[model samples]
Target: MSQRVVLGLSGGVDSAVAAYMLKKQGYDVICVFMRNWDSQLNNDILGNPTNNDPVCSQEMDYNDAKAVADALGLELKRVDFIKEYWDHVFTYFLDEYGKGRTPNPDILCNKEIKFKAFLQYAEELDADYIATGHYARVEHRDGDDVMLRGVDGNKDQTYFLCQLNQHQLKKSLFPIGELTKPEVRQIAHDLHLPVADKKDSTGICFIGERDFREFLKNYIPAKPGKIVDYATKKVIGEHQGIMYYTIGQRRGLEIGGKGGPWFVIGKEYDQNILYVASGDSNQWLLSDEALITGVNWISSTKPEGDFDCTAKFRYRQKDNDVSIRFINEDTIYVTFKKPIKAVTPGQAAVFYDGEVCLGGGTIDKVYHNNKELEYL
Candidate 1:
């Protein structure tokens, strides 16, 4: 009997190709389209409809997904995860921003929804494994599943999947992990897939390409605040809200008619003050170390106590050599080998040893010298 693999088939080139590849491998492929967001259910806090788009993007995506599944001769299933996404991913997203911290919802979405909820759905289908189009690879060795970076360095997505655990990795498959973006597109083209020439989706997951501030205002009430200079402590300008702005953000300050351009250095949550410093690479933005919490170790070979590895504080960032000291079972204090700029709280600090992913944790606090940057 052929192994049955349930695949998450987003209406995009990558996932379309993933579905095709799984079928070619002789697996009984079942394609599922996950509907995780609905603008109708997401009204403003004041009970007014926020989105007014004439055409719904999610519906269009489902149409494309159905076309792909039909062309590939696979069974397509549509599932609603809107409530689960709200409770698990979106709530945490709003809470982190409320605390004046920049959170990566993509990380949490993978941990809670794709691998957890969707994996459960796949299991109920009596499948041997679940697959996606993520550009990452899993290696089974010595009775443990190990995640490795995708072969395409530029398109590697292991950073987002860092929060996945042993069981998730064991049952998961990344069909396009070894292929580059162009290669995946080419395969789709050859297969005459409808999404072969479709543009890749960008911006926040499910939120689509809407104005970020406007979309956020639908959920969190915006409180306008004052923007201050960090070095002089002088009021420079006014801001929409501290929650909308993030550390190291340079655009949309609207503080025009200035001596020069300025970048957000920190945020005072209690005071509702947004702090800025002149110049893009301000010294005030640099940090020497950070305190990480909610750590998850995915590697089969776990390191005890203090250890050395390379880590990326944000996605697409080059790895940096770091020293890690275990503070607790789920926490660590990491000292960067070099002074890294803008190590913001609530973002992930994903660690890697060569190509193998060693798991990671969310950044809780940042420090320069020995003093904590409590303002952020």
Candidate 2:
């Protein structure tokens, strides 16, 4: 019998093509659609009913996934991880925001949900490996498995999966990792899959495209705060909530007649103040060093002393040259070769040695020169 592999069919063009590739490669492919959220319980931030609508987009995704499975003559399995997501991912998301920090829930979803929850469930099916549509690659290097960036640099998703360890990398397969986005879409189109023309999903994994502020208001109560101009330390406008804004944000400030556009520079959570600076290139927004915590080294061993590598503080950002020094087991201090802007706390600072993902951790503190930000 051929080796069995469980493929996560997310009702997207990328996953549809991944399923086809896995099946063609002689693996006994079983499609599994993971339902990580229940829209019935959704409400606006203000506790108002989201209102009755037609079938939720998730249900439509399931329908499309089923169609793709049927078209490919594969058996589709459905699994629910709503509870797991709430406990492992959503709680952390709320906690980080509550602390006035910006967290990337997509990165947590990959670490705690797809790799952890989904991998365990795949094991229950007696499968040899589990596959997904993520644009990243897993390779056996030396005596261990290594996670590498996908061939399509623009769509490489290795950053999100930076928390994954060697064990998860060993059991995971990214069939579309070697193909470009357009190539995957072309394959899906050629195969006549229903999701071939479907648009790519963005934003948080399960949340889809919605009013972010309105969605967040449901979990974290909005507290009106003062928006202060950093240059003059004068209150320019009132903000809905300090947590709703992030460093380097330019829109929705509503502070006009200031002679220039305003950019968020810092936040004083205790004082409930949001600091803004005029002009796109504000020196206050730049940080030369940062303290990172909760580091997970993919190789299960920490690199010694100071080392040079390229790092990315946010997704889709060009990697910047930096030097990292270990502060302890779970913490490190990084100094960038060039000062970068908006190095927000609670976001991951992923390090890379060429294409190999070296793992990362949440940014805890940002420093400008030798001094820490006043608000932090």
Candidate 3:
């Protein structure tokens, strides 16, 4: 039997082009646009206040995907995964922020929601494999599947795909892994797809539009608090809420003090306190050692003993040269060659060796016991 491929169409150029390419590959192609977010919330963000479209309608997106699906003469499937999305992604985002932890909801969304949910959905439909517009590469090593950064370095999304396991990677497909963004757009245009040049998706993972601050404020109320200098412990200004802010934030602070502009280095969730420290000093919020928990090792187990690897503490950050030690079953102690700034407590530290992504987990704490507080 021929391989059956199910591609997720976002009514965008990437996915449209992806479907076209898959069909050209001689595989059985089926386009599935998972309606993950509510349409009422998204249309409002797109400035469609009237919002005639029902929640999670994806009417416009579906139309664009359908055109590509029909052009390729393939089947199309529309699956509503809103309940799963809310339980897995949206709720996780809110709960993290509620606790003053800046969680990467996209990472969770991919690991638990889209890839896992859609993979199961496809299997139920008797599909052979699941494909998407994700700009990452997949490989098999030691009979275990692995996810890696894409060939197009600028658009590489291995950061978001780090959480996927061996099973998901084995059954996954990334059609645009080798093409640049422009090349993708060109392919879409050549195919005469309606979303040949659709604007790239940004901000939150699924929801296309909506003010993040305003939307977050709905669930997590803005509790007023003082912005204090971590060095002086002097209260300089006020902040709406500590939960709304994260490490390395400068704007919307509404605070100005001596020693140049300050950035948010930390937050006090219990007291509704906000910590402001100067970026001029390298030591303000920077630290060397980090404790990572909730690890998901892709394809295999952790490396034996301490070894050299590049660890990225935040999204879009270049991998840092580091050494690691397994602290426990799920926790690891990672120390960077140089101090990495703003080691936010809630962000994940993804470990990599060249293009191969090992695994990553949420940062539990940032410690600096090796340094001296006497210097400050």
TM-score, per-candidate, Cα-based:
0.96, 0.95, 0.91
Best lDDT among the predictions, by candidate number: 1
Deviating ranges (above 4 Å) for candidate 2: 42-55
Strongest candidate by TM-score: 1
lDDT of 3 by residue, 1-376 (tens): 6799888887888888888778888888888988888756544544655544333336777887788788778888899887788778887888888878889988998987778999999898788889999888887556878777888888888888878888898888999988998899888777777788778878788766666776665455678888888878898888887777878887788775456488887777777778877758466666888788988778466777997999988877877899998878788888888887777777888989888888888888786756522211
C-alpha lDDT values of all predictions: 0.89, 0.87, 0.80
Query: TM-score-based ranking, best first?
Result: 1, 2, 3
Q: Tens digits of per-residue lDDT for model 1 on 13-88? A: 8999999999999999999999998777755423776555333488899999999999999999999898899889
Error of 1 at 273 (Å): 0.3
Rank the models by lDDT, top first.
Answer: 1, 2, 3
User: lDDT tens digits, residues 78-127, model 2?
Assistant: 99998898888988888888878889999899999898999999999998
Tell me the alpha-carbon RMSD of every candidate: 1.7, 2.2, 4.0
User: What TM-score does structure 1 among the candidates reach?
Assistant: 0.96
Could you tell me how far off, in angstroms, the CA of residue 356 lies in candidate 1 after the best superposition?
0.7
What's the lDDT of the predicted structure labeled candidate 1? Answer: 0.89
